[model samples]
Target: MFIAIFSIIIVLVVLGALFINLSPEFGGTISDSQKEQFSKSEHYKDGVFENLGGVTMSMGFGDYVKGLKGFFGPQINTRPKGAVPINALDALELANYKGPARMVWFGHSTFLYQSYGRNILIDPMLGPVPAPHPLLGGKRFSEELPIAIEQLPQIDFVVLSHDHYDHLDYGSILKLKDKVQMFFTPLGVGAHLVEWGVAEDRIKEMDWWGETSFEGFSIKCVPAQHFSGRGLSDRGKTLWSGWVIKNDGANVFFSGDSGYGGHFTEIGEKYGPFDFAMLECGQYNKLWHEIHMMPKETAQAGVDVKAKVIMPIHWGAFKLAMHPWTDPVIRVSDKAKELNLPIVTPKIGEFIYLAEPTSNGGVWWKNVD
Candidate 1:
């Protein structure tokens, strides 16, 4: 009996190992040279990336059981009852777009920013699901993307916030790599892209506070209080970050999957008074509040960053937490109103012009069941 149980355990371990090794979705391993380079960053110590002040992902065994219960428990309104409304992108209009810069939210954290005729995609995870396999995480709220990956205009830059499956999809990268000119990521994240087929020369890995310029735009890799990993074994192996993108025309901030931290104030001080800001506002629970901000915190983050206008993201696409699907936008909007801050709630694929940032589509989610 003991021998049979031991054999079964061995077989299970072998299968798990094989699955991780054979799966391309797990992403690339860090090389010795990459590790050496990462060691120089203050955040990199003891061979793994550390968050500022450190985040407690799990308090203890009780917390783990609570998390499990939350995951498996019956939750209502976690997803929209009806199809999420999305607009089809006008390819000709996008290609010929001119003037004060514009962006389109592709649900969740994905956005297509066009400025001076250059197309930049941020966290372009356009796949159906945010997991290694479709069975693990369900499909996105919307069945079809505003524009198909093949139909996207030639991309000049692809800016990735981290190596998380939700933000950095393997299938999306496979389709985007050929058309993209350059890829920007936080430290050690390029290894994943390189492993996936992106040319090493085309990828630029930036440390926190690192700044660079391409054409007329100034791009800075800023700090975020978040963790990174595509597979179980590689947690914190790569860095995660928000971005400050600016040009002569407009300045923008993207709070890439962060919790409430002093970094927002720091970012604002260094590069604040942003023309627009897209902040994370969903997938938050009390247990994981240190990693993902609540909706109210999302509103305050906008004020901290000195943003002229803010839009709540990291929701509306996939249900990563137990909250109702509309809870994020509603709570954030209420908080924004209380703070006297302007907020834009654009529908998926709706264009948000920087010069005039407002919600052209009014409260569309209220109609959805």
Candidate 2:
């Protein structure tokens, strides 16, 4: 009875929110040109939607009942007894983030990269809960962004992997609209931006490998083995992808969120030996393992990109999966050591210098097995 009642409430709230996000008055998503253009992509044109539709129909209402059970299933994410306070990030302050090229893990997938005097943030999920309701889910360790949206200093660009609530929060975008210089995301994501009152000129969209230019940088949306749908209606209507951000001399590959696949080798050969790669390293289980890579697969992905140094991300924010909170980091480290992959693990708010951020030390997420 408890699960059923709460689930109905969740469904109602989510439906109401979706109505606002999808309505012409709220998000101006009535324009159909972007949708027409998006369907031209061979992968999303017909295949992905069919697949997702099939999955949904097969599940029926009963599957979601089971999913809710899974949601409230055994909890495995308790913090370590006498675990380090969130202060390990002091290492960043000790250095004063003034390096030529560096990246800071803001917990989960949010990271600030400073290179060539340009600052870019990838998937800045600063909210406490990835879900719409805080009481209904896990919590963020950090109180707020290390730098608030307004406090962000002349942000050059913001890149998004997809439109999942965890990746694209409405509150953050509304707060950042006036502050950010430009925004880049895969094709249909511009719908959300446009509805949020971002000018069409400021919003740029791309398909896989579709390139667009910023003054000192070039962004290319790359492929990821993932699904996309913020609500029931938008599934596969928008595209999901990883991204390759490049300057003249440096290449940074952000595995926005994905399962390990052949695209790794493809990206490596095309953008190999990257100075730094920030890859997803958490919130995975057998049910969706094909969509989110396990920790050892993350290490293999590092090698696939020919990355010199890998900073494992996507863990330590909200507990989305059953694995112990620290499991992702520990498993990746062990795999990195086994594979001889150079991995740079940093605490929340700590910055990693692209040149050699490893000289000091890394003890960020060191607890789980």
Candidate 3:
């Protein structure tokens, strides 16, 4: 009986190893040279990326059980009863766009930002599931993207914030590689791009505070209090970060997947008074609050960054936490009102023209169940 059980355990272990190594979705391996290069960043210590300040990510056994109960136990309104509403992209309008910068949120953190004919895609996770396998993460809330990936115009840039499965999807990259002109990612993230067939010259990896330029835009990779990993064993092997995009027309900030921390203040001081900001405002619980901000903090982060207007993102697409689907916008909107911060809640795929910001699509989620 002991030998039979031992054999079963050994077989399982071997199968798991084989699956991780053979799966393309697991992404690329970081070379020793890449590790040495990553070692220069203050955030990289002891051979792994570290968040700013002390962050508590590990939960005690009791907390772990409680989280499991909260996730699997009876829950209400975690997802909408029907398909999420989304606007179909007018490709002609996007191609001929010539005015103040416009953005279309494809739910969650994915966005298509257009300015003067240049198209930038940020965290373009257009897959149906956020996990490597569909069965693991379930389908996205929306039935379709703003537009089909194949129909996208020539992409000027593809910006990535990290290597997490939701933010850096394997299938999306496979579809986007051919049309994308350049790919910008934080340190250690470009390795995955290279492994996935993107040419080395077309990828530019940056450290925190690193700056680069393209055409008329100045792009900077900024700090974020977040962790990174895609597979089971590669946690923190790559860096995570936010981005600051500046041009003659506008200045923008993307808070990437960060927890509430001093980095927000630092980013504000360095590049404050942004014309627009997209801040993460969902997938949070007390058990893992240090890595994901609650809704109130999301509003305050806007103030810290001195954004003229803020948009609440990282919700509306997936049920990563136990809260109701509408809780993020509700809580963040209330806090923004108290703070007197202008917040926009555009429907999935709706065009948000930065110069003429409006919340005319009033409280759309109130009807979703």
Candidate 4:
């Protein structure tokens, strides 16, 4: 019995060490900005322990352990090849894009926006998987990118809403770090990039309302009811947030990831009447309702933001929730129409032209297997 106990203790110690040393960077000192934001923020939740406070708000080790177990356990459609891949059509087009704004969906929360001669990428994940260990996570639809990242215009800024593997991908950042001019993230998240070989000067840490400006664009980090952490040890030591983007000709809101909250009304009234709002509309379940909004809430968010048009994201790829994959679209479409909200349900990789524009949308995912 004594020897068995000793071996168990030794195994745990070894695993813990590997988790730390094998990370992109090791031992990031908690930033003062992170401390101030989380130590007092209402969104912060002490999931694992009371003393550590706000360290595991969005993702707990326990939650991930459960997720990994499920991901590895199931095979949704053990299939044959030659699958004509959904969105296999020419879903991409670099329109003269001379209009005030153009938005493109890259599946899930990844989007590319061009407006007023500025190129911005939001939660851009052009990767195969959305997990630290692909061995433990599921795959995305359509293995190929509709259009390559390098094929696009030069990126001026990259904004991240959170550190969740789905929103902030390791492969995407590694490729984008040098190509893009700068990165803006909530506090403590800079530590992750710093660990991953990104320059500190290029990474800016923002508290809830921190703002930064480029030539013709201003980005403000707004409060998102979410949490952060790449590994087990450093969860809400960082902050997570959506963004309010103010440009010369258009105001755009990028919801990196959020659950429904009254903050939407506050954001709309404060800096809205936005030309377009891109909000989440999927990967939600009743079990995690507080962190992922239902489809109805998404349309409501559009109205609250005073947006002329709304695009539902955080779906159409990666079944983080088991709702037949098409449920979110159907539900959101119904809700948006019911609420008299203007919506665009584009296929993966389709560029949306927003010329004072609101698109009622096409049901592109209709026969998606």
Candidate 5:
């Protein structure tokens, strides 16, 4: 009996190892030159990227075991009862519409922001599953998107927050390679893009607190409380960050998968009064609280960033956590009301005009069992 159990454990271990090595979703490793570049950043330490507040990557082995159990435990209401409603925008009309700074949230931290005559895509994760393979990950709540990747207009810029599969999808990047003119990512992340066939010249890698100029906009890589890695051994090989997009006309702050931390107030002090703030407000658990923020903390993050309007993102698409699918937005809505913060809850593919952001305030997901 003992031999049988031990042999089974060995087989499972070997299979897991093989899978990690074989999965293309694990992405590319940091080259020696990339390592040298990463070492130059203040955030890089002990041969890995470090978050502010000296955050540790893992909770511990015991907690990890608990997490694994929780992951396989029974989950309820993960997917909506019916097809998630989608309002497909006319791609051609959106491309030609010269209007105020507008954005269309494709759900779960994916959005296309157009303003100042440039089209920018932030975390264009159009893939149906967040994992490397559909068999390994939960399917997106809404199977059909408003528009397919081929339907997108000429993308001027692509902003990547990190190298996570959900945010930096290998499939999506491959499809977008020809359409996108430029890619901006944190330090060491360009390695993955380069591996995936993005031109080296088209990719701009920046460190935390680094700033770059593109067209009429000034893009700043800001700090976030999060760890980075696509695989077990490669944790912290790349940097993670939020972004601040500012121009003479308006400023936009995008919280790219960060936990609640002092960085919020710091960013607000440096770049306050943003026209809009898009923040992660989902996929949080007590065990991994250091990596992802709760809904109330997400609202406070908006206030800390001094945003004129706060929109809850990183929800409504994939079920990366055990919580009920609608728990995130519902909690955030209550928190925003408590804090008296202006919130914009737009339906998927609905264009959110930044200047006068309006949603029907419909609890569209409520009726979805």
Candidate 6:
């Protein structure tokens, strides 16, 4: 009876996994035509996408088991005791405001970037939760978003860095689809948007170093050191990347999610002296250190990319790692001060004016319990 019970339990677990994989939120697979195109790319190999500099996305069985054992280990201050203060957006003011480009961070990797008479939303995960299933992820750290999805102005373009749930939220996409004029993403990410009901014509799949222009802005999809997959299958089947936007002598770099690497220096050489840079700096651990940058590494990457001002992203939201909720900002600030890098620590929903060097965001998280 023990053997039979064990087999039944295993079957149930397998069925559960299969069900999750089949969910629409998991997204569609790459079609043969898509595969044919991907096969021609320098990054595609062995029927899978490859990271620059040969990164290992797989782990041995022994290492996997060890990781599982350590997965449920104690985390330190994963959530704040008090609410994270939020600054709501002024839609009217924002709509009327002109000059120097403006940005409002919506926490994590989401932000609204305005430049060249265009309003671009980057990784707009404005949903209450980041996970596909409500039970799967923790509640957002903030009490509420400053602005509702419907309240957002018509977005000129939506930029997705990759297909990860946190960065490519399904519900958020649905909300913005009608408002957005176009969608720009790294290759293979268009499948998710299509599955989520975004029109194919509105979606533009860009390869690494691919350039496109819209409304006088030169947008380029660049490399990032990360992997992508929404479900059990399709790992590394899509591309991940950062982006560079330049217009009217103002340049900006958006580091999606990347570890410390020569790519930063390479990007600097190609598009250095950016007016501003938004780099990921949270939800990182030693075990998965190859994909996500530690706080200090994030600061270094900002300098490497020749950014005049650096704003640490991918933090101050739901906790995805074991570190304290505020650890990322603290560490990055220390490193940025050490390097004398101009840093912006904006409160969630606060508008940041890019043209003014004195428009630095306050250390709002320091007062959060």
Which structure among the candidates has the greatest lDDT? 1
lDDT of 4 by residue, 1-369 (tens): 999999999998998688666755232546666565556655445521121222213556887677666556665532212332334323134523445677777888988788866678899878878777677577877677767665666687888887888888877777777778888888677777886778999888787767788767888988776666666777566778889888777788887777888778888988888888889888776656667889999989999889888988988767677556777778888999999888888777666777755343365555445
Residue-level lDDT tens digits of model 1 in 56-97: 465578887998998799889999999889999988887787
Would you list the clashing residue pairs of candidate 4? Answer: 55-236
How high is each candidate's TM-score?
A: 0.97, 0.84, 0.96, 0.82, 0.94, 0.94
Q: Candidate 2 lDDT, tens digit per residue, 54-170?
A: 322234586567667777787655444333334333433433444477777777898777776677878977777776555655667555555556566566789999888788877
lDDT of each: 0.93, 0.74, 0.90, 0.73, 0.89, 0.86
Q: What TM-score would candidate 1 get against the native?
A: 0.97
* Model 6 agreement with the true structure over 1-369: per-residue lDDT tens digits: 999999999999998787787677787688889989988889999878778878854567876676676558775688888888888887786666556687788899999887746788998888777787887898899878888888887888888899888898878888889989899999999998898888999999999889999778889999999989988778899999999988884799999988778899999989888988999999987777889999999999999999999999999987888789889999999999999999988888787777863334577776775
| The 10-residue segment with the lowest total lDDT in model 4 | 47-56
* TM-score, predicted candidate 2 vs. hidden true structure: 0.84
Residue range 299-356, candidate 3, lDDT tens digits: 9999999999999999999988999899999999999999999999999888888887
Model 5 segments beyond 4 Å from truth?
1-19
Q: TM-score of predicted model 4?
A: 0.82
Can you list the residue pairs that collide in candidate 6?
none
* Deviation (Å) of 216 in candidate 1: 1.1
For candidate 2, give the lDDT of residue 253: 91
Model 6 reaches what TM-score against the true structure? Answer: 0.94
Candidate 2 total steric clashes: 1
Error of 1 at 169 (Å): 0.3
Model 5 lDDT per residue over 1-369, tens place: 999999999999999899889877777788887777677788888889888868864688998888898788887886677878888878888678766698899999999888856889999999999887788898888878889998888988899999998899999998999999999999988888888888899999998889999877899999989988888888888999999988766799999999899999999999888999999998888889989999999999999999999999999899898888899999999999999999998889988888887786378887676
Q: Show the colliding residue pairs in model 5.
A: none
Which TM-score value belongs to model 5? 0.94
